[model samples]
Target: MTTVATSSPVSGARRQAAEGTLGGAPLGPAERAARGKAARARAPRRTHAEYEPAPNRADPIDVIDRQSRSRLPELVPLRYQRMTESPFRFYRGAAAIMAADLAGTPTSGIDVQLCGDAHLLNFRLLGSPERRLVFDINDFDETLPGPWEWDVKRFATSLAIAARANGFGPSQRREIVATAVSAYRTWMHRFATMTNLDVWYAHVDVDEVASRLADVLGGRGSRRLSRATSRARSRDRLRAFTKLTEVVGGERRFASDPPLLIPIDELHTGRERELLMGWLGSIVGRYSDTLSTDRRWLLAQYRLVDFARKVVGVGSVGTRCWVALLLGRDDGDPLLLQIKEAGTSVLADHLPGSEYGNQGERVVAGQRLIQASSDIFLGWQRVEGLDGQRRDFYVRQLQDWKGIADTERMNADDLTLFGRLCAATLARAHARSGDRIAIAAYLGASATFDQAVARFAEAYADQNEADHAALVEAVRTGRVSANEP
Candidate 1:
């Protein structure tokens, strides 16, 4: 790979071009934005629907590690933190697959959330402001654009991991994989033939979805399971949001948590809260542009209600995370947006792509490009933190009722239904960005991709085990620090 000196303005401009930023004369912000957007409208559009394998590429693992070395050191600690959550260090150590799959896949161009870590556990129903059950990918940390196949392979591999973790036999895992592959193939076919507007309007309401699944399953146990999952999801959101902000006559403030929520006593210097508020402004201006024409205006109307550094996600634990509560005409009329640091994409080190100036912005733009629909609040910016490094951040809503499957307790039948949904979601993402017709033709109405992934999963499983062992050694040798809570 060619290294460009980041210090030079010309090289920096070129680097920013890859990031979808344009430069021009010192025009007013409004004029510059209008001109840049018009240029984008007239720009040549190329879709990755037709893809072929690259020739004589370097080994993918080497490429991934090289890119990874340049990433923020905080990312390694974060990855380790999430991995330690389940003693399943293998799963934690091996986000490595995302790189390999991106490097290996045949092409189609897709633009969407990319899920960053697409797996069975990642997708769940989240409540919209209208209390409508809207389904969307809930994670954005590693979110970025690339070969959509990377998400698919990661999702499929995750299913395999969850199935094994849940104690399903290999045959059951294979059957689940087949179901998932089928769903993906079917969904891609459905999505490819869809009109752009139809694709944009797509969202699954959990109630209807549960009812539909109930119709298919048509049994007491299935009904009970569906109900239970729905309740868990709904309750999870409630648990996180109820204490989110205490709304007085018209102002919102977080309900108290002694140390967790940053006590009043902790504000002796008041610098932390000031830095947080500064970051919130960037979230609206930089992150929410991909929102629809109307929604962007509506978002701009809301005033900042409250913000605090809050802990979130397994992998994102301890990373600087903050939630900004936005109140509209009334205090009860609210919007909650989350601004969190964006780490390197799981595929970054592995895929053949230009280096990123800020991997977080890449994550933001990629998600907007690939997801059929995206959060109205999605945007990215860089902010200086106490550590002095300019942290790259992508911001979105917090506790939007986003839930994941209970992988720990799922049975074979549960895996079958859930894995298929995960697979179908992945394919929808890929179909949007990749040449679906060609991929469909390539998949050639067979389970070849499925088989290839399974073999890859098993092989990578060993690698994960080795990586996990290495992580264990790192902890023992004081290469990284942690405290068990």
Candidate 2:
């Protein structure tokens, strides 16, 4: 595998600021606030409530089919099947569809390192490098610089859809959605008043958050939170090692699981397998070069034992994903790493392309920029696949102390509180990369923007349902194929 060149799209002035060498004096708080106020005049906050589909809107199925063309043919059916499970499921996999819709929405001309697919599920519990559990945005697949409103709108819409799935009434759904937007608005304003270093250091500690919410959660919610945290802590590297690997002929290797976890040895034979393993080994070596000096030394201690092409997530099912098993010292010491394919950002069509030439680099850059903490092994590399095509891929631990919300079991009260937490986390992420003061200024002290976004969330949830029905009809009429597991 050959190495790919890296480059950024940021201009000299912006790059200087990013590198801690401001080209000139930065804008004062008052000037930044004025700029935000001017943007409000250009795109009134009330206008954000509107969400009528364009007369010339493209067919949603066509959009799905277009994305499928670049994915593995056999697994495309599986992706459709997952999406067909429910409207919320469809929304999870329809980032590209939403990116197009968000392009026509109102914005405050504010750009940030967006968590392109900032749905409610994407905000979750993660283990920081310091071994502390923190609530933060986890997915960076569709990340790019774009309007801040796009992320807010996608997140709010997800709450609306999820609330609907939980059998919430219209008033309940409205309150849930509004809670999230209000949290984002209020937190952004709070960040605006702090020093840049203080804002940068801000993060929500899971333990502290749970303790504070004890009274609000009462009996059932508190128990649920306790269970989730316990489950997350148990999902360490050793746990994944035991679950995914087994000894065969006195050798540790990945177990055979068709279409999901097919071992590399199973896919090729004899000399071909030898060559494939050597190629993958080289790719791993190249990826290590992207890490810092100390991390590179740490990674060098582990020897690659085996690898498998594994399927993962809703939209990522058809993309090439591999789970590499490495042994550090003995059979008990293992490190599981997931190497996932990175494609063009969904927002690329509607906004400026990333500065980074390699898509994998783009993902890594965005993650490092916004996440309060990141995986030590995180890195990216470009590799030539067996198909003779080069693809970009990012690597990270397969499982850390990761926990996702159980939205299915949540009540209206649970959802409202959970949505607020997600919104606050998202705001912290945005403040790390965007103009917090300007954004807070545009939102103002009123609930106008919050109420407007809640309205948009409901309307867009309606649009999402229609789009989901279109996909279901397509599958029924043989326009699309769906494979049930």
Candidate 3:
């Protein structure tokens, strides 16, 4: 309901403060940052070292159960299975669990468009519009405006958990956490000095990342990065077309793979498929309106040929996700769009409701606001389910040169570099949505905040391991059934 004049430095800084507070209303970015820096005396940076869970903390399994009630029942076991893969994997799927815990952590009251699930694996390589490979936050499923430290803490904890799973020594894991926090803090400071446009335009190019790593790691790391970058470049629409579809009766259709990838025609009876296709067709029309005029025109060229259900991600396995296969010009020219169900973000329970009534619109809007370059075809619509209940869904290119880090294969040096890269990328994302000057000043030039967060990360990783163990125990005792595959 409140709006700030972004054009004026002093008014913008004043507006950055919480509503009903006139504390430093006449200041500029620098002064606001200085005020935030002075705030350390009251909410000391060292306070982040504490990581005790609340005495009344909700049971992790109970929280998981609550979320499961909204997802597809049949695919629930798959979500459990992926989560049971390792402590790191469980940590990846436990954002809701972390959200519950984070509600009780020390917060600076500075809000930002948080990645909400800012784990290390979430930061990866993707192709920018110029076809240049860049590294940025690749998932915004749980994005919302919330305290900045929550994102930082979640990221740091993930680094710690991942390092432990990778068999790193205690000191090595601590170093990774330290490196990550230092990178986030240092980058925020850099962003604080930059003009608005400069911050907006900044991105972490993978080639530059590789070059920087090359100086520190010599040929091996650089070669590994080069391979990853090359692999990402190759995973465009053509690659998806070749791998996910096949010609059937003179028409290209999605190949069926049971329990993971199922063509809609195969999953439902003929009459049911007919009814579903009609709804899907109408949904596409609605979703198209969410795009820009040029993009909608570009999408209008592609004729929908077929669609299939898809199981994706450890945390997202139980959600309704479908891939629509479209033919643009001919059999060789194709575009695959993923229509994924969107629900309330984990942060929504703690923060204000989204301005958009549709959850799909929330995801689409948050992605556009935070991502450096979003999918051109990204859009959303509301569709009625088989049960006759309407659900929100967002659509985007299924695989537009997206790549994820193989955290399982990373060594200590590789992991630390990864931590720094992810941390820096997160800082850039926060700078885009929050008061970077204040965040930077709160972080300060010294290593106090970094050190405190490193300690917190180490402690929270222990809690995550224990929570993961509880899930494993539930599976073992037949309290929760799961498939290992």
Candidate 4:
């Protein structure tokens, strides 16, 4: 086995090339492949299988606690409670922990706009701007420019953990992880041969994918896919408006559900309420400036009616998330937009800081670069809080054909198929922002990289189990408080 280098001259050049500022004319495919072969020699593919924790590795619980300091105090425990539900749930909330660990791992030094938190659950069916159902990555909270392998490792490990939750044996688990890695390798190779425009336009249409897999999915998996696609198509703005609002007296208002959803009026009163409403209303106008001309014109038609502080997702429970209800023309025409707080990515400390000053812009820029299609209303802004602190936020439709896969219901075959879909989607995303030819060259036409990543996934899954156990112990001994919401 080749020993990994702490820093290499080749790695530095690769990073510069990945950033598209390598101080030279564009390299042809042959030169690019040479650079990739050099990277492979410097960091052998087999070296990726290693996963021994450093003696001075940070405590996972401490990392969780540090992240909580910036979050709502009351809701931090709920984040912990949600994570403690299972090892898979724990993995979902533990991206920071994994990011810290991945810093010590070997990489090809290839950088891309990473999803940061690329767990399998984050890949799902979403509505494209054209209203077609597409399978793509939906989360960008932790997105940043970093090693492509970090996203791949995070995704593969999530598969291993989820397999364990479903009672899969070690062999079956390895197969599942390898299946995804192989798909990534295969897709990257395919992308290497495509034109830049083609690569940029490549996307997975859920309907097309369903048609392709109809034979292999069998009746059960086929039905599940149909239901998922149906649910996604039904989750448009109208559906969100109907489910989340009610007629209060004479006007539509956000329904109040404590802990999960609290109306703005319920949280503030008197002069404070008046000030908050004004600030939130101003945010709509300010955020609209970030959108394109057509989108801005469209947004100008909607009046901000109501907003609420809502608890959302496992890791994001404590972070400030607001759902705004907007109405156009009359009471019946509505748009639901979510304004979520954006913080520094979990990978920030491990890699270089983001070039965008506002974290919200960082997220928006990343999403636009990586996703083939994005929400029409996606935009960002900075707002001053009642406490006089300023925070960055990104706004988008609250539920635009969003559908998450139910992992618990998936059998081994179902998961393997889902893994393949996620892997291909991830490859397409990476290819858009990184050198596809070089990455494909490093992966080669071999099973070595795939097998090594599968091994690493299983090993890291074991480490994740230990970390989850530590959190559970902390809660049991009252070192950390965990309250179910």
RMSD of each: 10.4, 2.4, 3.8, 6.0
lDDT agreement of model 3 with the native: 0.84
Count of backbone collisions within predicted model 4 = 0
Q: Output the TM-score of candidate 2.
A: 0.96
> How close is every model to the real structure, measured as TM-score?
0.72, 0.96, 0.94, 0.96
Clashes of 3: 0
Predicted candidate 3 versus true structure: per-residue lDDT over 182-296, tens digit per residue? 9999999898888879988999888876766678867888888878888999999999889888889988899988788999889887889988887887778778877777777
How good is model 1 by TM-score?
0.72
Question: Worst ten-residue run, lDDT, model 1?
Answer: 42-51
Task: Please report, in order, the local distance difference test score of every candidate based on alpha carbons.
Answer: 0.56, 0.88, 0.84, 0.89
What is the C-alpha lDDT profile of model 1 across 1-485, one tens digit per residue? 12222222113443333222446333333442343334323321121122232466444334333444644444445545556555343463445534553465444332223556776656766665566665655565565545455676667667777776777777777678767876887787676556645654565666766777776665864766566556646653345546665655655576666324642224434776566556566665655554545666887788876666665655455556667767787755677777777766665565434345775666656565445456556656676765577777877767655655567776787777877766765676555544454344334455655665665554444445555565566656776654443
Ranked candidates (lDDT, high to low)? 4, 2, 3, 1
Candidates sorted on TM-score, descending: 2, 4, 3, 1
Q: Enumerate clash totals for all models, in the order shown.
A: 19, 1, 0, 0
Clashing pairs in 4: none
Q: Model 4, residue 479: displacement in angstroms?
A: 0.8
For residue 204, model 2's alpha carbon misses the true position, in angstroms, by 1.5
**Which candidate's lDDT is highest?**
4
Report how far off residue 279 is in candidate 3 (Å).
Answer: 1.4
Model 4 Cα lDDT, one tens digit per residue, 194-281: 9989999999998998898889988888898899999889988899888888999898999988888999989999998899888887
The list of candidate 2 runs beyond 4 A from truth reads 1-23
